[model samples]
Each structure stands twice: as structure tokens, then as C-alpha cells.
Target chain A: MALVFLVLFVAFLLVLLGRRKPALVVGLIGLLFAALMFRYHLTDQVRLSL
Target chain B: MQLLNAVAAMVLYSVVLGAFWFQFGDSELPCPLCLLIRIGMLATAFGLTLNAFWEPRPLHYGIALLGAVLGAAISLRQVALHVVPGTGSFGGAVFGFHLYTWALIVFSVMILAIGAVICFQRQFEAQQSPAPSLVRFAGRFVVILGLLLCLANVIAVTAECGVTGCPDNPTGYLIS
Candidate 1:
């Protein structure tokens, strides 16, 4: 998940260097990925606790 | 405004360095989520450093906002993991607060700072034209620090996590 965030952030940076709108779009996508990762993490924690 | 970005970048780098201190000096490998938070900090610092080099834009602040929000969420989750009455907190206390608690405070402050940037957009714009001489000098330092921290993170993560990736609860470096 950390690697995923790093890749997405790098992509966001690259896209940002070229275009604004696209960069924003990429950032939103990154946010979605983060949300998904967090959800998975939370679920895993729950399973562990159970 | 640019000065603000430079200073913010420096401060973020210091926090990351503190994380590195724990990782290398203390031989405590960070959990996967902790690493994610560190990456988030780097991303935020990178955005601020970028803003220091160029005119402040909504996009730059937007990136920082995303990083802070993501990092805060992860930190909050880490805090939640130990919130139960009987469970002991992870890691040793730093200044009477756990590292994750410090992260939450830092992220909260970062959110407010980003909000300030949004609120004072006009001020940032007004100051952009001349591109203060101080920014020219400080910007380089921010860039160097940002890169150094990023490199250190990459090296440390690779050493600990390896190609297989980090364990959920990392105990130490996994370099075999």
C-alpha cells in the first residue's frame, strides 16, 4: 500500500507537470486508492481482533 | 507565501527524519501503515517544495491537502488500534505522546495550513510576481531536503519490506 501511494503520487507529480486538470483527476484517483487501502486495512484489523 | 512553503517543507522533512531516526537508529521497522503515512508526508513536502519553486497554485495546495487527509486517516487508524482500555500502545512514547499521535497533530496542523493557503489565495498571488529573493535561496534547500528524505525512505523501505513487501506488524528489517 505504501508502494502504491508512492507510485500514484509520482504519477500525480508527473501529470501535474504537464496539465492542471489531468493532475487533479489523478490526485482524485489517488485519493480513491487511499480510501480503498484504508478500508482493507480496517477490515484486516477487525479480522485480527476477532 | 513562498517562504511559508519553504518552511513547511523543512518542517515536514524534519518529521520524516525523525521517523528515519526511529527506523535506523533504534532498529525499529515501521509497519506498513506507518510507511504510508511517511510517504504521505513526503508527498505533502514535495508539493510545498514545488510551490516554493513556482507560483503557488490551487493544484499545489490541492496535492498537499490530499496528502494530509490521507495521512491523517491512516494515523487515526493506527491510534484507534490501541484505543481499547487494555491494549498497550505501539512504540515508545515520544515527548509523552506516541508517534502516531504526533502524526495526527501534524496532519491536523497541515490541514489548517492548507486551508490558510486557500483563504489567502489572493495574497499568495499578489506575492508571486516578484518571487521573493529569499525563496530563490530557501527553495533549493527545500528541494534537497525533500529529495534526501525520499531517497532515505526508499532505501529503508526496500531494506525492511524487500520485494515481498512489509508485514502488517513489522518487527525489524527483513533483508535476508
Candidate 2:
């Protein structure tokens, strides 16, 4: 979802400004957002493909 | 140098932004696979953004490479899905190719390009020293652009899918 990138972008910005710790935290949040998005997409659709 | 990497990411973001605009303009709805491709693009962009800001390292390039590989895989999967003789393609096609096909090409190119760029050890040294004003400006500009794009997608996706998750085949914005 866009939230994933939104979180990661903020994290990237944090690192650019010389904030490493916060960037890591934000990056993890982004990953979490991505995981949720993936779960939702897969579970909702539940398609089978080769 | 680092500026070029940032610019590369900028270009990638621009392409996705164009697609986002086209989606709204043409009333095309992105399916779940399409959404994954976008995420893959963002993941790759994230790695490149890191390289642009910090000192260029093999690890950073590795991150970018990983994202590209995964994205390419997803793109390929979608292409396979619609490649059947009778099955129709998703949304719309651009220049006779679906967006997934383009995504595969972009990620493939990014993989090669990153490898070529990583071979140059000189650029890595450039970032250790104080970056020039232009590089700094470019870095800020690219990140700001990314922020804005993310904001737009977040709002747009929310309006499109709401909290229930995106539909397999979306037709229009859903707020209920």
C-alpha cells in the first residue's frame, strides 16, 4: 500500500538528515505496513495461479 | 555520482506518478497484482534513495538489487497470468504493453544499471567528502518528491479501497 512507501520515505528522509536510529524504526514501520497490505490483498482475493 | 542515483530514483517516481495520473484520468482501477508491482517499485526506490543520501556501499546496492529482483519476479508473474490465449489483460495497455510488462523491463534495467554503477569505486568516495550544494539540493528535492508521491498514493488508495482492502477488480472509488 501507499502507507508502506509513505513510512519508508519518511524513514529515508530521516536518514538523509543524519538520523539513523529513527530511520531504522521508520523503515520497520514501513515493512509492517507492507506486510499488512500483502496479507489483505492475498486474503481478500484468494486467487490461485500457476 | 550520488546525484545521478538520486535522479534515477526521481525518474522512477515520475514514471509511477504518470501512471497514477493516467489511472485517475482514464478511470482505470488497479488490481491486487498491480498494487504489488507499485510496492515493488517503491522498495527499489527506497534502496536507491539510501544510496543517494549516504555513502554508497555494496550493502546499499544489495538492497536495491534485492528489491529489483523481487519486483521483477512479481512483474513476470502478472505477465504470465495474462499471457494465456483466451484470458484478457488487466486495466489498460500502454503502447501495446501492459504496465506489468513495463515494470518488468524497468526492474530488469535497474538491475543491470545498478551493477554497472556499482563497479565504479570512485563515486563511492565522493559521498564521504562534503557533498556539493547541488547534490545536497538534489537529495532534498528527490526525497520531498517521494514524500509527496507517497502522500498522494496513501490518500488515493484509501479513497479507492477503504479499510476492507482493495478489490480484485476495482471499478471506482469506494468510501463505504
Which candidate's TM-score is highest? 2
DockQ score, prediction 1:
0.24
The per-candidate TM-score of the B chain, in the order shown, comes to 0.92, 0.91
Candidate 1 runs further than 4 Å off: A1-37, A45-50, B124-129
* Per-candidate iRMSD: 3.9, 2.6
Task: Assess the local accuracy of residue B5 in candidate 1 as a C-alpha lDDT between 0 and 100.
Answer: 89
lDDT of 1 by residue, B127-162 (tens): 525666787778767766665565566667777877
- lDDT (10s digit) by residue, model 2, range A1-50: 55665676687678667786676567556655665665565553435656
lDDT of 1: 0.72
lDDT by residue (B9-114, candidate 2, tens digit) is 8878976786797778887877777776777677677667777776567766776777677678778877877888899988677899989899999999999999
Winning model by lDDT: 2
